[model samples]
Target: MTVRAANAEALRRLLAAEPVLTDCVSAVEAIGLEPGVVLHAGPPIGWQVMCAPVQGAIVGALRYEGWASSEADALELVARGGVRLEPCHHRGAVGPMAGIITRSMPVFVLENRAFGNRACATINEGLGRVLRFGANDETVLARLAWLRDEAGPLLGKALRRSGGIELRTLMAQALQMGDEMHQRNVAASSLFVRALLPSLVREGTGAALERLTDFLAGNDQFFLNLAMAAAKAATDSLLGIPGSTVVAAMARNGAEFGIRVAGCGARWFTAPVNTPEGFFFPGFGPTDANPDLGDSAIVETLGLGGMAMAASPGAARFVGAGGVAEALRITEEMREITLGEHPYFRIPAQGDRGAPVGIDVRRVVTTGITPLINTGIAGRKAGVGQVGAGVVRAPFGCFTAALEALAADDG
Candidate 1:
């Protein structure tokens, strides 16, 4: 079969997979993660080259793992190679900004029932001085501890008891409710709470339960990471299809942006990261923003986040797209670089057209159009939380490189 044909078939299987949130487990127990191991977002990079947020997050992970007691100790350990830093994507996982995953952290597990594939993501710690944003101060540590002690275990029990939440179902519903399942997850988060409220209430009592409920209620973007895991589980199934050009993943680590092609195995094509253009929070501006960061772009990989923009007019202003028309333009532009429209994720504004899916490197390079991503902007300095939100385009060089490699193989 032709590479394009194979890619189309692979994407069909990917979009067909129905991922379900089945359980929650510690990174250690679930993925056999161990101490002295830190998983960050994007391609594998060493400590010396890591961006500030990533470096800060690694230090936080070290402290969380009890391998270091202070920022100085963490710095010394990382600089001296006392701990190993790997990409979360390499470990069947996904994370948001900095995307730090540690052994003791609890991760939500999602399984693609159609193909029996699974992927996981760490629970979202809401905005403001959060660890994922590179803050490792006492407040951050205390919040992580509270989640470890109360939320994770309780949610695990509730999920197992409820027989799991159907993630794709939530995604379909959420798209209709104005959530692209990335930058905006208000609907998905609410739906998740609605689905689990009974289980949460039935399985517990008092402050622990109240805290979990409150956490879910307060974090509007709680379901974004879950959507990313679901997308990862679905797309991972498309990997290893010889001749297929479907992109398996796209991620960035402040310093670089990278992508993995379906037929390219583990190889990564990387380029310098691009700064996102968008609005900033109070006292924050473009100068203070880190280059695009996070594994959450997995959502866009599956055709939701930015590609579903026309369906999510409510999210436009927040991500720098001024209005619905601008959002539609972004989504329309993506269709040119993608293989086809998604079969399930429909955009109402586009007359129920499927969201664009299957990023094609050849088309991307030929058109000089990269995938669009809507994301949170972390502060450039370590330890500062999210400073703004915006839209970014994956660097064109990554696609050109991937296209060149594919051309060489085809010959």
Candidate 2:
């Protein structure tokens, strides 16, 4: 089959994906994550070479799991190979920056009803000093414990009671309401809360309910993890489509950026990650920013994050990506490298045009336009948490290499 035909088929499968929030459970239960084994975001890397934020997250996870009594102990344990590290993507999951998932952590499960595949992601821990951003303080661990012990179970029961939330519809509605489902998810988070509130009210009571509601209300990015899981499930459905050059995943490990092509199976093409260029938090600047990192790029793979930028001019401005004109330019440029537009994820600002989808390595290499990712910037130092938010391009090297691999596979 021609690459074009294969890519079309892959896009069709991806667009047809129906990811739903089926459950929330411990990572061990949801993904069969073994004790002593933890998943971090992006392509696989060992403990020694992992970025400080990822290492910090691991240390935090070890403490949260009670496998280590202190940060020093956690470091020692890792040095001794007492802990195992794997990429969340390898296990059908995704997470944001320093995306660490421990065995006991509660993970949201997304099942692709159309494809019968599932993906999972940990709950968002709000903003600053969170585990995902490498903050390992007692406070961070405490919130994680609350998520696992309280919020996870409650959300799971609510999901079951509501017969699971259909994410595609919700995401579409969110796009229309000014969410690109990556850097800015305020509308999506609100809609998600609304969808679960009725069921959540039916499932919990008193202070617990109040706290959960408060947390949800406070975290405008709470829908991000859910969206990541949904994206993972949808994109995973496009894997291994013979002759397809469509990018199935794009992720960063802080140290490296990687992409997996549908035609090339699970093989990854990687390059040095780029530091995101955008506005930083108070007291932070370019020197304080880490390279782009996160499995959240999966949303872009499914054509909803940066690919849907035209749908959220506010998100563009918030991430220092300029105004509506720049947003429109970015989305239009994205179309040059993608196979088609997402049917449901339309941009109202662009006359309700569908968001570009199906990143094609051939088109990227030919056009010299890499995929733009909307992402959070972790502090260069571990445990410092998020420093800013911005846009970064998936390394052009990754796409060129992927294109070569696709050619070799076809040959």
Candidate 3:
């Protein structure tokens, strides 16, 4: 291994590309849902990740499906042997909070034409203790119903009318506006709202219009999930890329940490999950934090999240804000280890260069640096759920294994 860096043009050819987005049916197979199928994560979970917001969301979904009389029944069914829990990602979907995605839920679909793989994610619930974060209560449930009955249909109608929102441009815009498009999506959400306004206004038939206005008025985080989904969809391109040592995805549950490599297909290399070290909410400390959950880390691998931490200093409060200079340095440091840079997510601070791209296992092994993850903290005690969110680094062992695997394959 050598310490030399490639020239700019060489780096450009080595990395810098965008994946495509397509419909789930045309893109993904067997694992994805058709129009009629609502996917559920059965057992094991027991809604243990069940925070109040998520419980309310699950109950709302059950209610929406006409399967339960009230939320009480929904909870009862979830607790007993009645209902099934499913990972939204399994069915070509991603959700926020409990991220319980339903079948009819309109999803943003992305395809990797180069590799013949695809990924999907549900829209974000925006900020607050929304159901995606596992918050269950009247406030959370009512909001869920409104999104289902009002926002969901209206947005779908708008998309139908206005063709569809092109995610490529949106992601590019988000990067310049200080979003890595994964952990930090403020700018992307604002842009998405602006893009959807015309359709929302057109579909505003009395109640729909009123709901649309209300949702937009208060919800700044609305587009986060879409941004994450799009990133997830885009990064899937690196999957199955032969001889490439890029890090495609990084995710964790409270129990384990995992990484998927470009050369390894879908097989996950996992390590024991560790507790995150950073700031916490008032009245809560390290004791309240859960390990980690969700597939959102895909955004980081795509050159967002902590990698683009330079763009969003305000993100520090949410994840134990680092010094401004330190944040900026962090993003710069990532290039030493990454395999490529994102084609769409360019950083203004970097003179409009795309954000540091695909993570190279070889680069990481050679440089001895691990990936940094900024994640939401879930409570280990279940029911309580979501203590706070913060930036944390992934264990080096995870990357080491991935590098070794990629190296062995090269031989």
Candidate 4:
């Protein structure tokens, strides 16, 4: 028989229990209500000062919504402060990549009735020339149109017919398929393709099917953002828990990298953001990379991305293709500051033990082991998109100050 306890402590343990997938869904669920909802990039921003990626998405959205004839016209309205700019999380949504969510766009909706909340995120249409990454070229705009007309409707209909796919199941399986669920998603992408096939096949085959296959094949990193959204869904549930020291979010916005600790509520401790070291596509080099940006940090909260480096040996190219031993060593160092092993994702080499579970505030304070981040490098200058990708660490000063503040609070 299962033992029951009556107390806040018990509740904390219980709430933190359940598979990671459940927690991930909870974050997505927290965002509530409807399509056509405009989710912006970065923190809450006024109508003015929206970044390029978000701006690009907004422009595409105008076209998607039949509100504007061209991006130039769309820019005029956005500049004139006509359409609304809202936070994605506020509307039960999350955006991966460039993270621009607009109303009328089809989103993968995850609902948690137990908590009376829902989370939504736009589909990952694979990589390149897509709006999320700030690609708003004519071809990109045309593809977005096709997605809204062909891909979106067909997939949305199939999803609706199937009554929605559970993301937790996909998360659980993806880890096994070589997805760190944050930095790498090869396995998750495969699993997503498999789960989506039956439904996709039913939507009927033609240029659409061919397009779908090509989309999946072309964009290998598609599911990382989805998993990050799901992870965001999960970690957000743990927010505002009384006296808990868990971290709710960790992210960067090109200018700064920051994190939130559960015990302190919504305060963020940020460090001067640094550049990533990654292998670029042909003709690209270190000079091309941009400093990291975006809010898809929900990945780190789930214990992948930089936390599960051992799972992503191939990530070295971005982080500095040094050696597998160095990669293993970096992942192992994560244990120095982590709390426990993730009950859901287990490292194959660790005798199937769960991947390093939590990032402990105490460990950070005591050991001063800042977390490592493997990220794509974007150009510092605007409009360059991604120049490279690689690994970097949380600026030590950020952790030291945050830890010091936490210590003072306890004292």
Candidate 5:
């Protein structure tokens, strides 16, 4: 077992799995996801190096896939390619920010149930102008068509009548109620609407249970893209693992900033996408942000956003830090480039320890210290949605090119 202790025991059995939100289909039935195939986020790009909030969410997913008919004919059919962009982590799926995913939207699946594996995302359209911050106007295509016609079949019939929804026990009770689940998912969106409020009142009513209870009581980052599709279904089960320097998927697409390593199977060790810094929003700043975009940093590859910013001092004062001892000194500089700790995402100010999970691209190129996300700045051009909230790092040339491609696969 010495391929780096079998890659730290395959990332300690992928941080001891347990994803579970079960279902809420339709990115063409949870992942068959056909039609025009748009899924965006980071790494597999095109449409002429897309960016302006992923070309305004690919012209709001080509007008939510009618194929066009405005947003300038969906940017002239995505500048004449006519959709088909790909890379919602090559489709197990994960979206947030301009992480677009189209074909009749409504996602949120999850699954990992100790690795049966499945992910998917899509539903949160709460923020202003929406369409994952790219804002495909018309009130973000009528709130993505009322989250695809009345809150995705009443939250997929209250997630099949609550047969599922353990998402790491609502991310360990939303990191003890302060939520470090990527830019604060306010107590995991109030414990996922109090476990879908008894099946959203026994399957909704009156404007579909008051527009799914005012879109989950006004989105406190609506459980951050279902906790980034349950951290991409629990780290896509530690990707390939060969000699795993673990760090599986930390996306972005407002330009670039990828990374996928558990033995580098799916490649993508990108760079460039930076521009975060912090605090802005009353008339915006940093020249109207947007650079680091979404896949909601796959919840810092499964530890908790910003590697559990010291158990989230209100997500380190909403990403600008200056409290809880600068969020426990940025979780002690992310426990020196992370390798382990998340036995259950603990972190009560670092004494209750545990939340730093395996990011180790050779300990981020021997501690150059990348990976400190906590984002949400978007709106550089697109329709001007989110314009501030900060901290962003991940990109020391994607951990020195995944440590020079794991030292050229060290035979």
Candidate 6:
């Protein structure tokens, strides 16, 4: 088949996806994650080559799982191969920075109702000193434990009682309400809390309900994981479309950036990752930033986060993408390389136009325009947590390599 035809079919499948938040469960329950098997963000890599933040997260997970008693012991365990590291994408899941998901961690489950495919992501731990950003102190561990033992189970019960929330509709509404669903998820998070509050109240007592409500209210990024899961489910539906050059996933492991093409099966095209160019936190600067990292780029693959930038002009200043004109220009430039616009995810700033969707590798190679990703920057050292938020471009080399492979297959 022709590249255009193949991409058309892939786009059709993507547009048909109907991702819904079906349930909440442990990583093991949701994705069959086994003991000693830890999933991290981006393409696979060994402990020796992993960046500081990822190594820090693995150490935290090891201690949290009781597989190791200390950071030194955790490093020893990883060095000896006592712990297995895999990419979340390898197991139908996605996660934010550091993106560590252990067996006991709670995951949000999203099912693509139209395609019968599913994907999951661990619950967001809020900002600052969180494990996702590589913080593993007692405070971080304690919060993680609370998520595993109390908040996770309660949220699961609430989801069960309320049936399931349809994510596409929620995301669409959020886009209209100035949320690009990454870097800035304030509107979606608020909407999600509003939807689940009644069910949570029905299932919890005074203090438990109060704690859960407070946590949800305080974490404006609470909906990010759910959006990641939804995007994963939606994009996975387009995989394996023979000859299609559409990008099915984009991820970073701090050390490397990678992309998977729909027609390329499971093969990954990778290159050295690029550090984000944007603002940093107080006392933090470019020198302290880690290279872009996370499975959160899956949202970009499905055309929500950075691709929908025009929808959230307020996020521009926060992520250092400049003013409204820059945001609009970014989205417009994105359209030059995408296959089409998302039918459901409309941008009100663009006169209710759908956000661009289906990142086409051929178009990217031809146009030399890589997809922009909205992201949180992790600190260079272990345990520093999030240093800032910004916009980064997926490595251009990944697209060129993917296009070459696709052309070879066609030849």
lDDT of each: 0.88, 0.91, 0.62, 0.61, 0.81, 0.90
lDDT of 4 at 295: 65
- Candidate 6, residues 310-388: lDDT per residue as tens digits? 9998888789999899999999999999989989999988888889999988788889899999988899998898888
**Model 2 CA deviation exceeding 4 Å by range:** none
How many residue pairs clash (N, CA or C atoms closer than 3 angstroms) in each of the candidate models, in the order given?
0, 0, 26, 25, 0, 0
Candidate 4 lDDT, 32-139, residue by residue in tens: 433434566444555454445556667776776677888788878777766776655445456764567655555665554334354556666665466765666677
Which RMSD values do the candidates have, in order?
1.0, 0.8, 4.9, 4.9, 18.8, 0.9
Per-prediction TM-score, please? 0.98, 0.99, 0.80, 0.81, 0.34, 0.99
Give candidate 4's root-mean-square deviation (CA, Å): 4.9
Query: Taking the tens digit of each residue's C-alpha lDDT, what string does model 3 give over 286-350?
Result: 98876656667767777778877776666654577576777778888887887556665677777
lDDT per residue, candidate 5, 1-411, as tens digits?
Answer: 345885787677678888888778678888787777788887877777777877787787788668888888777776677668888889889888778888788887878877698888888877777777777867678778777887887898888898987878778868976789888888888888888798779878787788679778987888888888888888888888787777888898877888888786788888888888888879888988878887888888887888788888877887787678888888788878777787776877677878888778777787678878888888788878888889888879978888888778865
- Of candidates 4 and 2, the better by lDDT: 2
Cα shift from native, residue 45, model 5 (Å)? 17
Q: Model 4, stretches more than 4 Å misplaced?
A: 1-38, 45-75, 83-87, 112-117, 380-384, 396-411
Residue 228 miss distance in model 3 (angstroms): 1.1
* Candidate 5, run of 10 with poorest lDDT: 1-10
Per-residue lDDT value at 203 in model 6: 94
Candidate 4: Cα lDDT at 223:
75
Model 5 misplacement above 4 A: 11-16, 22-50, 54-94, 97-130, 136-138, 141-201, 209-228, 231-233, 236-243, 260-269, 272-400, 404-411
Spell out the clash pairs found in candidate 1.
Answer: none
Judge candidate 2 at residue 243 and give its lDDT: 93
lDDT of 1 by residue, 1-411 (tens): 689688877788777989999888898877888778889998888788878888888888788778999999988887787888889998999999999998899999999999898899999999889888889888888888877778898999999989999988778888988998888999999999999888879986898888888888999999998999999998888888878788889999888999998878778899999988888998998999998899999999999888788888778789878888898998999999888887778888899899999998888888888898998889999888898888898999898888888878888
Strongest candidate by lDDT? 2
| Candidate ordering by lDDT (highest first) | 2, 6, 1, 5, 3, 4
